[model samples]
Target chain A: EDQVTQSPEALRLQEGESSSLNCSYTVSGLRGLFWYRQDPGKGPEFLFTLYSAGEEKEKERLKATLTKKESFLHITAPKPEDSATYLCAVQVGGGKLIFGQGTELSVKP
Target chain B: DTAVSQTPKYLVTQMGNDKSIKCEQNLGHDTMYWYKQDSKKFLKIMFSYNNKELIINETVPNRFSPKSPDKAHLNLHINSLELGDSAVYFCASSQQRQKGEKLFFGSGTQLSVL
Candidate 1:
């Protein structure tokens, strides 16, 4: 069965702290991996899309790196406004995108 | 302007009642999708429409039906709503021809069934 799992269901960090979130997948044919940031009472906002292994993408304070079996979203000196649930999804055959339980990050100022 | 938008931002109803959530995307995308997020914040795809055609339907209950009246509109109707059906339903869109393109999501509709 194709599955995506994210580690650290919840993360609490002080402002300007750094951390990393993990997303591991076990799909037969991996077409793409996407990262999204969702805030409370709002929909998810697209962050980055990693297509193959060793691919990395960055925006502002967040950087996403993908590998053969897992992906990592690294936060460098995050701020309170940067706190949100980060979602990871893997695209499978027929354009089916499977999502993992998101990691809720809370940065306290 | 909103790229993707859904109506009835909040829906509260009793069990066994029927309701519908409407969605529209102005991004000119070829594909639209419905995803459900449970209390645990786990998102799961329910249905997908590509160019107004049903393309992907996950293991969802028959009571949950998706209708695409046109290329830019996809609505989800639930019959005999149950308490377990309470969740945030999100509408999303993407270009099917553009492989690996990021999906644009709308502000989710929060459904609460008592």
Candidate 2:
């Protein structure tokens, strides 16, 4: 069975603090790993996609790195605006995405 | 312009009533999907349509039906709504049903059943 698990269900970080969220996945064949940020009362926004192990992508203060069995979303000196629920999803050979339970990040100013 | 759009951003109704949520994507994608996010924030896929054809249908109940009149539009109609059916429904589209295609999602519709 394909499954995605995100750890640190909730995290509270002071402004300018750096932390990392983890996503561990088990799939039949790894096709893609996606990261999304969802705000309250809004839909999810795409953040990054990593296709292979050792791949990494970055945007501003956010960086995502992938491994064979897991992915990490690293927030560098995050601001209050960076607070949101970060979701991790993995796509297998069938093109369907299996999503994790998301990590709620609260960056206090 | 919105890449993907869903109508009735919020819906409130009583149990056993019927309702529909419409979704349209203007990105010219050939594949569209419906996902439900429960109160626990667990997002799950309900259905997927590729070029107006059903490609993937999860174990969702039969009361929920998805219609894709065209490649750019996918609508969801739920019959006999129940309190347990209340959740946020999101519409998304992808260029194709490929292994790594990025999906564009619309603002979700929050459905509340009394």
Q: Considering every candidate listed, which one attains the maximal lDDT? A: 1
**Lowest lDDT block of 10, candidate 2 chain B:** B96-105
**Which candidate achieves the best DockQ against the true structure?**
1
B49: Cα error in model 2, Å: 0.3
Runs of candidate 2 with Cα error greater than 4 angstroms are: none
Model 2, B1-114: lDDT tens digits are 988999999999999999999999999899999999999789999999999999999999999999999999999999999999999999999999787898888999999999
Per-residue lDDT over A29-66 for candidate 2, one digit per residue giving the tens place of the 0 to 100 score? 88899999999988889999999999999999999999
Question: Which residue runs of candidate 1 sit more than 4 Å off their true CA positions?
Answer: none
Kindly list the per-residue Cα lDDT of model 1 for residues A1-109, writing each as its tens digit.
Answer: 9999999999999999899999999999888999999999999999999999999999999999999999999999999999999999999877778999999999999
Q: Fnat per model, in the order given? A: 0.75, 0.60
Residue A4, model 1: lDDT of 97
Candidate 1: tens digits of C-alpha lDDT, residues B12-83: 999999999999999999999999999999999999999999989999999999999999999999999999
